[model samples]
Target: MAVRSWVNAFAVIILSVGQASAESSSGSLASSVKRLTDKFMATGAEGTPPGIPAISVAIGRDGKLLYADGFGQASENRPATAGTIYMVGSITKQFAAAAILRLIEKGATLRHGSTLLKTTTPVSSLLDIANDWTLEGGPPITVAHLLSMTSNLPNFTRRPPHELDPWGAVPAKQLLGGMKEYRPSGYPGSFEYSNTSYFLLSEIMENVEVGGSSRDYHRILREELFTPLGLSDTGFGGDSWEANRLANPHYRRRPRFSQPDWLKGSGDVASSVIDIFKWNKALMEGQALSPQMRDLMLSDCARVDVWTYYGMGWFISHKDGTDRFFHSGTVSGYTSYNLIVRPSPAHWVSVSLLANSDGVEGVDSLADELAELALKS
Candidate 1:
């Protein structure tokens, strides 16, 4: 499977938002969480050979940063820090979803050829999508369906005739030309993981917002979320990211999807744990989206399992006393996981783990462990 397909498809455990009071966090709880995190990193992402070169984690509780840390080397010459920027894979989807919903909420519109269309406009109406994009006899796919991964469209990233090479460059025209024919997978209103869905969502955003001109997802994010949230260390990978400053992806390095225009909004974002935490904090605490939109982002989820739901750009997990919302991603040699777990009504926590290597075993297990620990403490 291609790296982009692994974004939201990798979470295998129950996890969500979390946090505790400052007073309690200053003592044993703080130490406990930190120690637990350190212990996990001690094994270097567990079971992966030439294992994780470096990892950064940011944990929050009650809207406050509880623990922020880094482990291992970012590169031979530098040690990783909480600030080291790593390609944050599919976690980029949340930003895209938020941008779309925020635009929708504010009645944001963009030119689509001769007409102007708003965010709520049907995707079929916004872009030149295939007729087979939806299941037979079903209604045309909408912007909301694309955002929520309920579009039931077959994935283009790993499927035949359109499998993408994330490590190579694909021109915008060639990429769009490939989405011409798609056989629908799964059923309507059911949760099915599809990287192609977000790709379509992003095209809708660009064409509608920028009139489908150039690759401007990075600019869109900066203007909409990063700039407003003060996320200075976050952006798409490339010249914007100084080679020495960005964490060197381990295991598989070089030819590393340098031109990620093909990935687009599906998996092109690179960010730090600190900045990601702030974004999550603002999001969970209502700064990023209105309450109504936040509710939709989370509650629009369709149950795919006993405990997990595929919501708009995130997975909703309600299990083992944890009300969790999260997403995980990978591209080339990086693995990213961001989570929010609420142990109780008044307490919520978010943990973000950014690693330089692709196979970071126990990523979700670590999340579950933290949630279990938070509840017990």
Candidate 2:
């Protein structure tokens, strides 16, 4: 098992590039992208233990692919390609959030009394607080709460070191039962990101849908969110993806870390750069979701800080007087980021960067570099 300390360098950042002319003007930006990509691979290739085998990057500026490249090999034996798959860590949150919204579109609402009650799986003791769970906390724990991460539940990621699982497997139900009994760290209105809350929500989704599986919800997403949006390559766990379309796993201070099967809904979806770009375009164009649902996705769920804002399932940034909606994911050996500017739908861009090494360490810095290059050009 490998552990990431979430050091200062591992933060994910999203920067907005003004609506640059979408003409044939990515030459200089392409060069900068190459420089950043080169820098990352250079460090990894020359690491003390020699970093993982490869890296793949896709950058979209103002809704266009300014640059996409593959560095190193996608697999230890196979050469990496532009479409390689990568484990997009917590970035899976927003996608899960989007799936929840699809349920709402189907007439299922996240009301006060509605929750998943009857499932054979044992719930974790930590989640017992949700047992007597009424929707009394501020705004009822709607699918939105799970999305914005303000349901007042504790984020399992922030748990004590011994309790957190870098690569351990505990029954999902056991973890949920534990959370059920545990008291929330803050009021519902307070901003607290909890993977436990989403886990519970995933269960509830299972109850609402015909089949009791988060995979079913993803199946629905395929129709409501993915297919219509042309995101053929985006899919939940257990899919047969193209060999050339998957990024090899990357780690830091460790050789390999297998992701837990139970963490599927929280962060186990596999995706490609082109797939995310298509998803971003659909989300911006209101193709995957209704205009109303789109607004709900951006609606502020909680205020994390004076500068950083959060909405249902997405992060909002108000910089340079422009508002942007975005999210980032960090999974074992992988780091991913996506951001799209509102109002200026054409000003949409998504970045998917993967390395066969713990590349997320440079997420924020790389995002900054990508944005600067894209916007400046």
Candidate 3:
């Protein structure tokens, strides 16, 4: 209640000052900026410690950035500035989606019945698994399913009864072979969240691109999507501290699995709020892909049995009598959300919250709070 009151007061003051400035040419732009900064700082100071850590948010209308701000620290006691870099987590799925779309535009074969079991790759065992990978009376696993997280492949890393492994740096084939051992839960077109499916797509993409490493595939994204869109701050690098330019992960202080680098294509990408803003712009403006390819990436790919409206890589929400397209990411201690108002697809917003915190519950609470705040804002 206090925060809401304060925001209302601040907005009124800002509007008043702007009106006064029109009458008297004495107010400097710096003064207006200072006032805005102070307003944000006041809200953040009152909102922090559990409110949200270092949020870098970019709100846009029609592919143009209207608001961008970074609040809190990149880590405990460390300030997060405009330059901080944080892991975008499952937001990496968007990049993977775009990359696969690029392959499709280039005529890579990802049609029905594209088997991904590798003969020379690390998971040589999955070649056997591929033998039985039928449609199960429906469509086979296509590249489209992989991009949309609809393959419903059991996450080999997080199988129950046994602790999920954080050491995903194992060769891609090994990951698939391990996944083959898990029991099936649903069919190919079923919508389910699984990092393993994206990693599997990454393996197949590695083979699709000529003489390209997965890193190369990502670099292609950097050069094509990010660079052209002015998202230089977003990238995948080997250093952990690179994420400091973004919010640090928040988690309760508990023993948790530590991730390894081999998980690169799945969730190892580092990015900034501004970079994602540029990404959203590029995606919506059709800068990175042809119009048809862009539609395929955003189109509904599958249906979630759990949620009537949610499907594939995106979540569905209703506000003001409209449906919103969005996705959220969580890894270890960090949680983030990306949402774009759809149909028009004009307004977009993303919030990234990081706590050196733990436990899925706390992280989820933080993400939910941040998302609610974004919706209201």
C-alpha local distance difference test of each model = 0.71, 0.58, 0.53
How many clashing pairs per prediction, in order? Answer: 13, 41, 17
What's the distance in Å from true for residue 201, model 2?
2.6
How does each model score on TM-score? 0.84, 0.76, 0.69
Q: Write the per-residue lDDT of candidate 1 for residues 236-326, one digit (tens) a residue.
A: 7764565555898775645444465667778888888878888988988889989888888988367878878877889997777767898
**How far does residue 112 in candidate 1 sit from its true spot (Å)?**
4.7
Better of 1 and 3 by TM-score: 1
Q: Over 4 Å off in model 2, which ranges? A: 1-27, 43-52, 109-129, 134-140, 158-171, 210-215, 253-260, 341-346
Better of 1 and 2 by lDDT: 1
**lDDT comparison, 1 vs 3, better candidate:** 1
Over all chains combined, what TM-score does candidate 1 have?
Answer: 0.84
Best by lDDT: 1
Candidate 1 lDDT: 0.71
Model 2, 70-98: lDDT tens digits are 66777656665555666665666667667
Give the runs in model 3 whose Cα sits over 4 Å from its true position.
1-53, 109-129, 160-164, 167-169, 210-217, 240-250, 253-257, 305-312, 317-321, 343-377
